[model samples]
Target: MEKKKLITDDGIRYDGRKLDELRPIKFQIGTLKNADGSAYVEWGRTKILVGVFGPRESHPKHLALADRCYIRARYHMAPFSVEERKSPAPSRREIELSKVMREALEPAIFAEFFPRTTIDIFAEVLQADGSTRCAAISAASLALTDAGVPMRDLVSSMAVAKVEGKLVLDVIDQEDKQGDSDMPMAIMPSKNVITLIQMDGLLTHEEFIQSVELAKKGCMEVYAKQKEALEEHFKKTMDREEV
Candidate 1:
């Protein structure tokens, strides 16, 4: 991989990181009182909040299954999340993202343990500077864990982009739009399994494989942080109970 510039002669991509570097991520679990679980994640300028509810009765008709709980995810971008205000309605893009998010999370969660029930995950983008979808999935997993939902492994995610013909680990908004390729992947690291993947733009087969490898590497870092957050959340809960 060759490193080049997205802006400035310094050869730094946007957000001032070298290629193969991820944006700084900050996450917190158990942030909501109403939902069974909730979490917040911030990467670069992108911020997302996720709420997990259920393993409860399924409403409506035809959607419910007797064998296992339904996994539903909603990914929404707030009007103020972008530079221009976006519509409040769940557009086609939002719906598609939601569907993809659900698939990413389903394998990690033990949905079969809650037959005839439903698990609903709602992710809202508070600010988007790209990589919001990846962040959303990561946040949703944390929220599910906070809800005490049984999961095979914590799902962690990261993105890689081709900037100036060089593969970069994470792309901010400007670099993403200008980049030649963007690949996002979510993984159950302990299981060594990929739960979700998405690609846009173009890449050779070799580039694609390399991108996947790099994304997995980034996700491992994310997984460690997520685990730490979970530990801290439980510690706080235990302390509060004791007090």
Candidate 2:
């Protein structure tokens, strides 16, 4: 079988987006009534929902920390999320992503304020197009805020990739599978702090620098949308209360 050309001479990708262009993104806050806080996100064809429950007491006493609340995170994908049905069992990638999600979000929240408790983040990917981890972190941050978790700042994340020798932003599944590199990053937008960053594949020093700059630009766009969605969510809530 012949390989598909990922990029054209005019810098258009196979999906008809230019290099550095992101897939369509949408966010909805407080999607679940039972959860303390919740959010749903759609990036391109990828969809993920995150729910936050607690600063409640830790179930196992030994798991509680005297100084700060423990962060318990889980990342799971539905069996029918991808074209090929995923196994219901948690895979190694899911376990790793869960840990990564925790770390990415921990720096934003003031865990010390709620001692001997646990803040649970449940992220479910209903579909997987690409950059699911980045979308998960973005949605999880909003869920934290919706749960009334006080935080120093919110995290926004995005991915950068190199396909057919052209660097692109907001990588999709096709690009990631065939591309030369994939770098996912999370940052506290207001504080200018990087909470999580990981790169796979190869890049030169120059390309790495360029990719970081590009990723930062993409993350800022995500951050702006996140804030806009939150503002809209709160506005609707207030309007409903007034009615």
Candidate 3:
């Protein structure tokens, strides 16, 4: 099948965004009451909810670490999240994504503070357009903060892609499906340290470097929004207390 042109000659994407432009993004903290901490994120058309629990005893005995807390992340997509109905069973992709998500956020967490315990993070894709994994990690970081987990810094993430021979930031579903390459990265924005980087497709050495730089810029933008959401949540709580 022939792929549709993802980038126009004038440097416009199918959605009319510039090569470096990102779609609209919004975030909400403390969206779930039952979980210790929770957050909701909407990035472009992708929607995700993350719930953080534990820092309690690790179950099954063997999973507990003697020196530091363990972080477990579960990534799931709702049956209705995509255009086609997805099966309820967990797919291999979800399993791998869960592992990477845990690893991405583990570095920023002060797990030694709660040794021999576990911190469980649950990420559900309420909607999927593209970059769901990146959105999940971003939301999960905030949820951990909402749960009052100690951390060195917040983790921010974004995806950059090559479409029609041009590198772009934050590709949507169509771009991901038809683009030449996709690279997602997670970093500690305050510390300027990368925790996770994954890529699919191909790129030259220079293009790889450029893509990482672009991804960093996109993640910084997301970090700002995350800070804003947390601040808004706290402000509302303080107002309620005063009342």
Best by lDDT: 2
Q: What is candidate 3's CA lDDT for residue 199?
A: 96
lDDT of 2 by residue, 115-201 (tens): 999999999999999999999999999999999999999899999998988899999999999999999999999898889999999
Clashes of each: 0, 0, 0
Which lDDT value does model 3 have at 167? Answer: 96
Cα lDDT of candidate 3 equals: 0.94
Clashing pairs in 3: none
Which pairs of residues have clashing backbones in candidate 1? none
Please give the TM-score that candidate 2 achieves against the real structure: 0.97
- TM-score, candidate number 1: 0.93
Candidate 3 global TM-score: 0.96
Off by over 4 Å in 1: 1-11, 238-243
Candidate 3 residues lying further than 4 Å off, grouped into runs, are 239-243
Per-candidate TM-scores read 0.93, 0.97, 0.96
Ranking by TM-score: 2, 3, 1
